[model samples]
Target: MKDSLEVLPGIELSVIHFHSERFTMHHELFSDVLEVNYCHRGRIGWDMRDGSSVFLGAGDLEIHTMDCCADSTITLPLGGYEGITVLFDMEVLEDHVPELLKDAGLNGRALLKKLCPGQTPLSLPASPEISGIFSCLFEVPQKLLPSYYRIKMLELLLYLEQLKPSHVNRLTSYQSELTVLIREIHDFITADLSKRFTIEELSKKYLINTTTLKKIFKAVYEKPIAAYMKEYRIRQAMLLLSQTDDSMADIAGQVGYVNQGKFTQAFKEQTQMLPTEYRKRCRLRKMEKE
Candidate 1:
C-alpha cells in the first residue's frame, strides 16, 4: 500500500491504495470535517449504520458527514481499490471564506446537511472534467501534491456547486435498526456469485419485513436487490470471459446461470456479445499483443 495522508492548515487530504484481493473495514469518520471520497480504481461499498448503503465505482465521488460510531463499513473488490479523500474543516471554511462557502450554495455546516438538506450521502458519477483531475492527481511530483490537492479540492467544490441541483445525487437515509442487517444480507448475496436466492427466502432468513427489505435495498444500493445481483453476476461473467479460458458452460455456471442459452441472452443484453465471441475477441487481442 502506497497510502499517503497530508494535512494542510485545516484540510486533510489522503490518497489511499490497497492491494488485497478483497477486504472490509469499519470506518468512523471525523466529526468536525466534511469528507469527500473519489474512487480512482476498483469499487468501494459503503454500508451505512442506518441500513442504507452506497457503492462508488471508479471515477465516482461521494460527500457525507462523519459519525462518531463506526457508522459505515467499506468493502473493496479484488485487485483492491484506490481512492482520494478530502476532509474539509467546516469551521475553517466558515472562518476563512464564508462568502465563498455561501457562493458555493453551502453554509459550512455538515456537508450532507448543507448540500443535501435532509438527505443521505451524496453520490455522483464524476463528469469528464472531474474524472480527468482524479486520473492525473497522482501523476504530479510528491513535493507538489499539497498544492495540487488544494487546487483540485477547490475545483471540485466549484464544479459541484455549478451543476444543476437535480444532477447532484442525494441518497436517502433509512431506519437505524435495518442498516447492519441489510448490509449482512447484501454481503451474503454477493458472497456467492453462483448461488440463486429469492427475496422471500432472504427475508425469512433475515427476519426482515419483505417490503422494507426491498425498499432499503434500493435505498442503500440505488437498485433493487435482484437487479443488483443480476448486474453483479454479469460483471463477474464478463471478467471470466476476458481473463480465463474456461468453457462457456463452466463460466455460465460460475455466474449462477445453469442454462447456457439463458446466459447467452443475458450476456448479449449486457455486453452486446455472446460469451464465446467475447472470449474469442479477448484471445485474439492477447495473441496480437504477443
Candidate 2:
C-alpha cells in the first residue's frame, strides 16, 4: 500500500508498504525529482547498472534522483518492505521556495545537489537524530497529519544540511556475482526448513569462502545465517499454525526443532506466545470471521 500526501508544493511524502520478491521501478515518470527513502522495517536491495547491489535495512536512509533508479529492479530479499519516501521536484521547489523555508534560509535544490552530487544514491545508517525525526512520522493524529508532515519535513532537511561528509556512510555494494550466489544459497537453505546448514558446511558446498559467505548473506538477508533461519522457521511455523491441524511436536520438527521444549521457547521468543496459544488465537479469529 502507498499513501501519498503533498505536504508542500512540489514536495510529496509517501508511506510505502510492499510485499513481494521484486519489482521494476518506472522512474521515468519522475525524471526531475529527488527521492529520499527511509526504511522503517525489512530490507530493500537495488540492482545498480554497474553489476553491483545496494541494500537498505531498518532505520537506513537512501537519497537519489529519479534517473538513478530508472528501470532499476528493486528486490526485497526478505519478501517484504515498509518505508517512507519524500519526493522533491527540483524545478518546482527551486521556483517557489516556501516562505517558511526561505525564513530558515533553506534551499531544496541546493540540499538535493549536496546530498546526491552524483548519479549513484547516497545511503546512510540512521543517526539518533534522524531516527527521532522519522519515528514520529509513523504515528500522527489524522487531523494533524498534514501539518505534522510539513514540520517534520522541514526539520529533516535542516538536519541533513548540517551533516558533514564524514558523517555519511561509505556506500557498500555487493558484486552481482556474489549476490546471485547468495540468492541461490538462500533458496537452497530455505527449500527445506527441516534441514539445518552450518556456515562451514555451506561454504564447502558452495565453493565460497566462509567469511565471504557470511558477509554477503548478511548483506542480502539483513541477518546472520542462523538468526535469519530462526526467524524464517518461526514465520513458516506461524503459517502452519494458522492453517493446519498438525500437532505442536510435528510442527516443531517440520521447522527443524527436534525438541518440543526448544521449539516452544523459540516460538515464544519471536511471538511472545507459545505455539499452542498462537494456534488458539488464530482459530478464534477464523471462527469470528466465519
Candidate 3:
C-alpha cells in the first residue's frame, strides 16, 4: 500500500493505492467541508450513520458534504484500488471563486451551504468530458500540480454551475445498486490478467445476462470490460517497466502479451511513447531524485 498526501493553503489532495489488503476506516467529521473523490481503480464504500451507503467503483466520481459531527465507516477493496481525493474548505471557495459566488447570488460560504446542506452527498452526472478532466489531473507533471489544481478547480466549478438543477437532483437519487456483484466481477477479471474470458463464459460464471453485465460493468468501471482489461494489462506492463529490469519481451509476456511487437504498439498507443523511452525516463527521474 502506498499513499501520498499534499496540502495547500485551503485544500488537501490525497492519492492512495491499496494492493490486496482489506483496509477499514471509521471517519467522524468535525467540520463542514466539501470533498471530491475520483476512483481511479477498484472500489470503495461508505456506510453512513443514517444507514444509507454509497459505493464508488473504478472511474466513478462522487462528492461529499462532511457536515459537522457526521460519521461513516469506510470499506476498502481487497484486490487493489487507487483513488484521488480533494478536500475544499468552504472559506477557500469563498475567497477564491468570487465570480461563481456572484452568479449564484450568494457568498462562498452561503453557496457551499446551499449546494450541499451537509445532509446527503451528491453524485454528479458523469460524462466523457468530466472523466477526461480527471485523467489529466493524474498525468500532469509534479511541478505543475499546484497551478493545474487551481485551473481545474475553476473548471469544475464552471461545469457544476452549468448542470441543470433537475438533472443534479435526479443524479443524486441514482445509486449503483448492484455494487457487490460488480465488485465480484471486477475481482475475477483482475485476479488473473493473463487469462482472457469470453462474454458468454463470464455471463455463465456470474449468472448475469450478458447485456446487463456489459451495461452495468461499463457504468461502474467507466469503460467496456474488454477495454478495461486491456488497460489493466498495459498498466501492469508500465509498472514492470519502471520497477523491474526485465527485457521488453519478458515484461510483455508477464502482462499476457505474447508478441513484443503488438505490445509495443499498444504501449505507444496508450502512452504515446515506446517502452524503452518510458523506462529511460523513469530511470532519469529516479536518478534526479537520488
Best by lDDT: 2
Models ranked on TM-score: 2, 1, 3
User: What TM-score, over all chains together, does every model reach?
Assistant: 0.62, 0.87, 0.54
lDDT of 2: 0.85
**Cα distance off (Å), candidate 1, residue 82:** 5.9
Encode model 3's per-residue lDDT on 1-290: one tens digit a residue. Answer: 54444444456677777665334454566355777778777766655554555657766677766652165545564356787777777676556554534565435465455555546665554567568657787788989977777667666655555545345432322233454576678888788766778888989998988998887677555578888888888888999999999999998888777789989999999999999999999999999999
Q: Mark the regions of model 2 whose C-alpha exceeds 4 Å error after superposition.
A: 29-31, 103-110, 259-265
lDDT of 2 at 226: 91
Q: For model 3, which pairs clash? A: none
Per lDDT, what order, best first?
2, 1, 3
- CA lDDT, every model vs. true structure: 0.71, 0.85, 0.68
lDDT of 2 at 154: 77
Give the alpha carbon lDDT tens digit for every residue of 1-290 in model 1.
64555444456778888765334455655555667888888766666544666667678888766652255556553347888987777777667653434566654564445554444567777578768667778689989877787777777666655656565554354554575577689889888878888999999999998999999776555578888788888889988988887888888899999888989999898888888888899889999999
CA lDDT, candidate 1, residue 5: 56
Candidate 3 RMSD computed on C-alpha atoms after optimal superposition onto the true structure: 7.4
Clashing pairs in 2: none
Clashes (N, CA, C under 3 Å) per candidate: 2, 0, 0
